[model samples]
Target: MNWPAEAAAGCSCAAAVAASFGAPAFRLLSAGLALLLAVAVIPVCAVAVRAENWRANVYNEGLPSHLVAVDKNRQTFLFFEKKSPLKLKYSFPCVTGQLAGDKQELNDLRTPEGIYFVEYKIASGLDFREYGGIAYTLNYPNPVDRLRGKTGHGIWIHSKGFGLVPTRGCVAIGLKEIDMVGPRLTPGTAVVLAERLDESKVPQPDNGTARELRRLMHAWSNAWAARSRKMFDYYDPDSYSKATESFAAFRQNKERLFKSLAFIKIYNREIHALEGPGYWVTWAEQFYTASNLSTEGVRRLYWQRGQDKKFRIVGMEWTPRDVGMRADFQKGRLVAAALPPPATDASAEAPLPPRLDMPEAPGETAASGIPAVPAAVAQAEKLLAVSNPLVPRRAPAPPPAEINWGGRPGMETDREETPPAAKMPSAPETPPVLPEPAPPATPQAPEAPEESMAPEALSLTPETRAALEQAVQGWNTAFAARSLADMAALYDRERYNRLPGVPRGQSYNSVQRDLERRFRAPWLTLISRAPSLELQGTLAVSRCEQLVVAPDGAEQGVRTLWWQREADGNFRIVGSQFKPEELGLAAHYLEDVSNAVSADLEAWRKAWEGGRLDDYMSFYAPDAVQQGRWGAKNIRRQKESLWARTRPTLVQLSGLRLLMDKRGIRADMNQVYADSTGHSDRGTKTLMLRFDGRNWRIQREDWVAQTPQPVGGSPAAPHQNTQRAMP
Candidate 1:
């Protein structure tokens, strides 16, 4: 109980005194510290857990294993697993064609939507850098597309480095993503490309039509084997008439071959059917053998349900195994064989040696004992017989009658009088009993002309000419004002509008969108001269030289506008064409202006990258206007603030196009900006510059954003200075 006892007793007394006085303050401090720790650790813990169990989460979503789905509208490709707990394996951002919609024809510039399978993978020697690092070919125009008459080829899923640029009817992703996903894919991997794919929705195949088509195909093959006329009956008589005057003619042609050959065999394989909007299509590989002659090819048949509720063949196309065979048949071998029967069987029998005058099939050598027919006879047969016997022959219609208006009877009318007007004029009041004409008067001296004659009749009246000039001036003013409403007011509202680069008639909404996009630039100027006005009654053509200046660049061209006089007596632009001046001093001047503007752009970019705020600002004119998220305003303060806060690390420019005219220059380019903070953005930048004696200075600037969001799908907050960087 001596020293140890005394020490324990003293510590107990000290602890009791401290706890009584400091308990309340200490508890509060402890609680504050605990709250701070929870705030910091909870998010980290949640993230860790999510990272560890993401695959499990995916499985819970019930996605099939090894399936990929592309959402074109969302620009995402999702990979799924098909295990006990279906899960999304991976997801990647992707790009599609420049335009949206299901592809319908070649050069439609749209991505296709459907269930497709990877036909094959292309991993090497794909020197085409634009296609990214790897490619997977898809079987587009698969039986369904062929039946719909949709034509195009070479649609693939590929990469274009690390950018998200639109593709030419192909699916695109980053190079790194392609590298990771391409190797995991194999031939026949199912891929569904749709505008959008809801995770909760299930996909179902329409197999009822496919089954019926299979039965039809079997019957077709059996008919060929039996050389029966039932096969011809499957074809719609009206459709068959397009190729032959009647189904009887078609049967007659087939009958000759059926009887001449000892036996006919058709082997069908790889049959596929797809249901379309109003019809269905079937495609199959058909192996044919007539006596000793044998060949293989693809046959496509279009079918539609008739009033009798049965599918009948409506159209047919054949692609031979050998491409040259099509040329040979088109040149008359098939036509000659289908011609009407000769007067006697002797002439027909001579041509029937069971030998085809066709090129040797693949893998066949000259030593093969296959007989060859004479080429001269084949050519003669083609020249003498029509290729399609169904087409009726008829004489052309007679030329139309010609008669002049208000002229002596039987005078030939001009080309414009094809349509006759209502009602005929009564004979002129019996000539009002005119006095007898005197004998031929002596020829008077040729009278001097009142005015020098013009080479061509002047169709434009003074009033019409003045009105056209005024309209053009109004249009020029509206363009300079950068007012979309004012610009639209000059166009005819009732008719479709057309412009340069737009061949098809454009709707008012489309033209309005175009105008809005154009006016988004801060400044625009258009000047025109030497307008030639041609008036034809209510229609007029105004052609002139035009110079356009905008933020993107300047352009010098010849603009021809079609104007129609409205019922209200005002002229409105109905259509227009802009042809860029390609030769002479204008072209040379544009080249010089482009070079100068480009140099200025490079200088500006260098200054920004170098963090020389003063030098960068120097490129702008005193009155330079900038349109951005803050709206059109003076950019001096914004630039100063940006330079104070951050500095640029990298700058990339691409797709630079220049237009130059007498007014100034405009430069449009894609700009990628990276900052020291590791944040990056890509957008389109348009700079309008005017020549300030010694150099080109920016008079206006506009930016349109095209940046991808962060990986987790949340968009980055708008940067104070960069908000206006995108459209």
Candidate 2:
């Protein structure tokens, strides 16, 4: 109590003394008061410093050497590289998902906070501006997330438009930032996201679990190299669920490959193990060779401890290395530091089985007069027989009385009853030529040699049909195998032609190049079904439904191939046509025009909602017509006024239909608009766009309003005065 009272008394005395004194006396009193304040503040500052919190500076000590740390609280992405003095290489402002908080369930719309890695870089030209200029994919819902029961996919790090808007559970930065950093980030680069990042801490890999995991991986590799089927015991066959084939099927397939190849070798490097919830993930570079073929790629294995206290592979994924990564590895710029030693157990050190000998010629026989087929070859044949049935040679069945054209063949029909076949009109009977037959029997008149019957139309024999089917199947298999040379061999290079929407003159060379480019992707597959073939002389036409699955997406369409039989009795594709089942286009002109118009409309909506005034107006032609209450003359001014007073939050277009002619293309669609003030409107929108040999521009736009109706109501009348036209 004495300190507080003494301070108060001294302040009051000093104030009174200063007021009552002259200028010289006041200056002396002020100096004395300043000295007194400094004396009082020193003790208080020392006490505050002693009690201050120091917990924020205690950073995690396990951060990796080279990594990206994202601080959600600060909205910054800091790039760190381990050097003599650890320092941030760069700092970039970043945006997260729409919702703030850690992601949990599917569609939570919240960014996840954890350590992850760049899965891969998306190819250019597949995404829209909404995804910024390009994107780098992230392995969201990774093993850890999945173990925690999280779901959803397609989370990425991308760029945004002009503004740093929210995302759908993805991290986004500016376009410039992506361009500057995209190339530097590669697969396996670490990305750590936290509410706050502490630069003082460095993360280190969990070496204990990593060592155990590496031992398990080496044992598995040793077993493979030794061609030991006992390796299957190491895999938790019952626990594994990600593979497309069952354990038995996988074992059978592997056994076949092992027997077929002369030798198998495996080299592993860049091994990394990440600890997840109740499991561990090990990823590494794998170089494999069988016979004369060699391939290098990245392989990931998810390992989980079983009841027996042994770690077993629960999941696996393999992907070919990216071109850039492969180049770097070849140049020794991205080589691994070191790989763990191979397994030393007696079983793992066992020698590989010898390759099977080729079967002898058909006429060659053993001493016992039986065909000289190796036992291994005989066993492989038996396995193949069980797995794949041989194409049987049999007589072709008669064509159906009436072919069903209502739906695609090989697809189930929803109709309750099958339609009856059309009845063929009875062939008219001709009167018997009895007298002519008797005259012909008189043999004195040498009978004219019977005219050879012309080959019947659509009469393909079973052998020929089987050959055609094999050709088509071969094409499909080649595509699935991603063999560009095999695919090119099936195509008629001399007379290759494609229908509209595809590039013209797609010769064998061009096709091969295209296939090669496509094969570069991590996922590419083509499947065909319900093939119908028609033969005419040496030419054949086959139609089938083709489903193409790629990294970007999947498309199912109808494809027609024209094949010409060569002198060597091989059928080759000469021409082909493909039409997407989603869009029912009447002609080629409408496909591109329709797509362009739809894209333009979407861009306009995006621009308007983003508040980009100049971009919103750029879609319109200079002389575009607009009709409203103020007529067409003040259309721009009216829009400007509306934009100034209100902001558009959402615009959705549905039921879009297009009609194109020589002049332009017309689009009719239903529109729904919502604004920041909670006002909403639904109406029909029509836009007319004209193409000037280069670009398509909006010539006219009309918006018609429909009165809101009660639920289950029949119809609503349009408001006559609500029509607004825009350029």
Per-candidate Cα lDDT values, in order, are 0.50, 0.51
TM-score of 2: 0.37
TM-score per prediction, in order, is: 0.29, 0.37
lDDT by residue (1-727, candidate 1, tens digit) is 0011110011122223323432223433432443444455664433110000000011121122356777776778877555444446678998776544567666545567665556545444465567764677776755445544567777889988546666667888887777666654644455667667655433233334454564565566667667777667677777544421234434554665566555554555545554433455565555444442333345666677778777877655442232123334333233111112223343211222222222233443234443233354344223212121111111111111111111101111111111111111111111121222233333322222244221122245567667777777677677767778888888976553532222355576777787798888765545555466664333566776665656465666787877766557777886767788621222223332444455566678778778787787789888776653222234666766675777677776543444332345445554667787777765556666676546778767755344233334332342333333321
Tell me the alpha-carbon RMSD of every candidate: 27.6, 28.7
Give the alpha carbon lDDT tens digit for every residue of 589-675 in model 2: 232234445556667777876767788777777777543222333556667877787777777654344443224545545566777
